[model samples]
Target: MKGRSILLDHVGEREAAALMVDGKLEDLLIDDDSQPRPGAIFRAICDRPLKGQGGMMLRLPEGETAFLRQSKGLRPGQPMLVQVTGYTEAGKAVPVTDRVLFKSRYAIVTPGKPGVNVSRSIDDEEDRARISAIGHAVMEGIEHGLILRSSCAGADDDDIAEDIAAMADLASAVLNDLEGTEPEALTEGDGPHVLAWREWVSAAEVVTDEGCFEDHGVMDQIEALKSPFIDLGEGHMYVEATRALVAVDVNTGGDTSPAAALKANLAASRMLPRALRLRGLGGQLAVDFAPISKAHRKQVEQSLRASFRNDAIETSLVGWTTMGLFELQRKRERLPLAAILRGL
Candidate 1:
């Protein structure tokens, strides 16, 4: 991809960041830059607690139960470390383990759970092995996981080790400050578009213009969520997102031939994911493709996965339901664009 630009509009009551890929607006990030983001470690007091299969649901002093796998030993009124994961659809708190993980340009240092993990982006087998070994060596005796980022591919292990050590000292300083501070954010995650910009357009120009949406082409890139139909050249897609799930239907626009219909369905399989991501839609999503033979199902699934491969968030393409709709789930971070824009 060519170099892009970022526009940050913060003049309004809410702040929004727009990412332009190759001079075209691609993603919108709505976040309050004045406040701290998620990933901050906090000393939270537990309220109510319940154990679930996946994790424990413990209400914290911040007024939301944290979804954590290691909440087994936590009890009510106890001060424990917690990290803000993100927000839910209803603006509820979602907290994770207090394990402070700091992401540098080259690596991620996890100071809470000591271990070694390599990023999935590094595909080379030998490189993966070498980075993992280096992580293990550097993280020895530390209660944290050292993740070798893809940027560390050609990096020297000694340099990476030094970076890890430096980050360890930073984490220690933050922890030491917790001795006096109450429940509050110690660090913040980057804005959604900021992360997207770093991963997709590293050298992109950044500008802040509160009036750029109507003046520039920023509005063109955002998905008009209220409009259910999305034009896809060969065909158009009708998308409906309820509180429970998101449903999308593919239909041929003008040409009704079987070949044309198949082409449209294939196009929908590829385009829908991008549309959803642009709209920042997440949670359960189901796509109803134009009818195709059972033999073609595998091909459609492959196309869908390939289309979603570029997304930063984790997306799982679950198999078709009994009614033939394809099921998938995307990890939700913040509210969708529609809600944020409409002040919902």
Candidate 2:
């Protein structure tokens, strides 16, 4: 696979990074860690006792109350390792977990769960078995469990093993250091742009524009993500995010031919994932492609799947809805791009 150039533009409160693929904004990343989001692991001190789900909360060292799982028995002043699992909205306590997840390029090393597992996205049985065997062999005596990523599909066994071993060392070091460290984040999982391009792109391919994000066309692209409609010359896509799911609608105005509709929908399908990543839209997503005949729907679906296949984030096509909407889901580990910008 060919690599894409990366541009980091730091202009406003939140810095934006654009992955330039084929001269287009393929992926967008924003630095908006003003508050914790999902997958953020923090070493927190419990300031109060946690009760049932009605109003259970734990005060962190930062003088903020975080949502505590009702089932866990926690007391005041108890130091605990908590990972944010989900955050529904801004200014609200996020759902958290005690399980600490350490992610690497090719695997996620999780403590307490010992064994090797393949990513569910890798559907090839042979590849899964091969990666699993390699994972288990490399992680045999380690206390942490390993999850082989899809990127490791065709990787050499030795390379995979080495990466796993390195992650194990990092995990052990992190766990050991948690004893005396102040309340702080330990590590961060790779986002789509970083995970997809960092290793593949050269130093020259990665460029940074400090305080010039708005000058180099990056601001325009970032602004596009905030709008509900994205014009694509031949067609336009409408993006709507509700509390429940992210919905996308593809429309081809003034063109009614089957081929024209297919072309427009295909373009929209390719653009949708990039928009989703740029906007940090995740959870359940439904894309309603322009009405196409049953014979051509499969082609559009395949194209959409292909578009998402290259994404660093794991995504799955869950078939079409009864109403002819294309259904899919993407992994949500951080605040949406829009939310991050909103925080700024």
Candidate 3:
């Protein structure tokens, strides 16, 4: 199908389940596909008159502080190598250390605003030759004196071209739409997952003989759904939040023995941190395991340590509280997926 239908349920014990897939609840619309959106970041010369800098400015594909340098090294008007120092503020491009700083804002290219912005109204020749190589580009913005990620290796001229084209196309569409219709439009490009999977590889070492796929992403997703408990039946538990000032409550559901239940809780604890990372939850966590013996507490602690073997985020367990709480903390810079799910 050209599109996927996602159903999210947040009303009852049955949290989320997909009923209809493509365009039907059964097997309809399973063969069609849609085109992917073109995404890019451009790098080009800035030839704009800055408010206080000078006659020429350097702009990056995404930053603001353009590296301002004396115009004495290269061609007067052409594209060259640059770096992404920092983003622009009100009206400036900030560059980093070791730069060819110049007095100019990066003029983000597009199909509409194709040329380098020289002033409030002036523009220079479009770097069409270099930009056309990309499939379809979009110029996000023009910024102050700075270089962009385009200077990095693997960011070919094709990316620049694609970015320019995308921006141009969007601008044209906006103008056309505005002249005859609505003024507000939302357009989003590819995101982090696309970038992360750019160089992903996988292999299968062990699997059931019945039906196993060669690609690991499939198993990985399935494993993600299963609870870490080795023999807890097919029922799986999903958690929300990555790191936060939160607490975990335990219930055996039907387990009877106190120590066994405690051991099960310990097993569950071992999996909690992993879920936190997967859900992108961060901050403080106070987990209360089922009341068990001190030995089981030790086991839980050890399991907690084991689960964090490959975490990129920093975490610390302050040991259990006198009241039987597992105190821990995870630092973060953004809201985790757990929060997103809960909020939804």
Question: Which candidate comes out best when scored by lDDT?
Answer: 2
lDDT of 3 at 160: 43
lDDT, candidate 3, at 34? 19
Alpha carbon deviation, residue 76, candidate 1 (Å): 2.2
- Stretch of 10 with least lDDT, candidate 1: 178-187
How accurate locally, in lDDT, is each candidate? 0.69, 0.72, 0.40
Each prediction's TM-score versus the true structure: 0.79, 0.69, 0.36
| Model 1 CA deviation exceeding 4 Å by range | 1-3, 32-37, 51-55, 59-65, 91-95, 98-100, 112-143, 153-166, 176-182, 192-198, 208-215, 223-226
Expressed as tens digits, the lDDT of each residue in 13-116 for candidate 1 is 66677777776657667774322356656666665555455455545434445666565676766666667665565654464765657766566777656677
Candidate 2 Cα errors over 4 Å, as ranges = 1-3, 44-59, 63-80, 85-87, 115-142, 145-166, 177-204, 209-216, 294-296, 316-319
Give the Cα error of residue 216 in candidate 3, in Å.
12
Ranking by TM-score: 1, 2, 3
Instruction: Give RMSD to native, each candidate.
Output: 4.1, 5.4, 17.0
Clashes of 2: 0
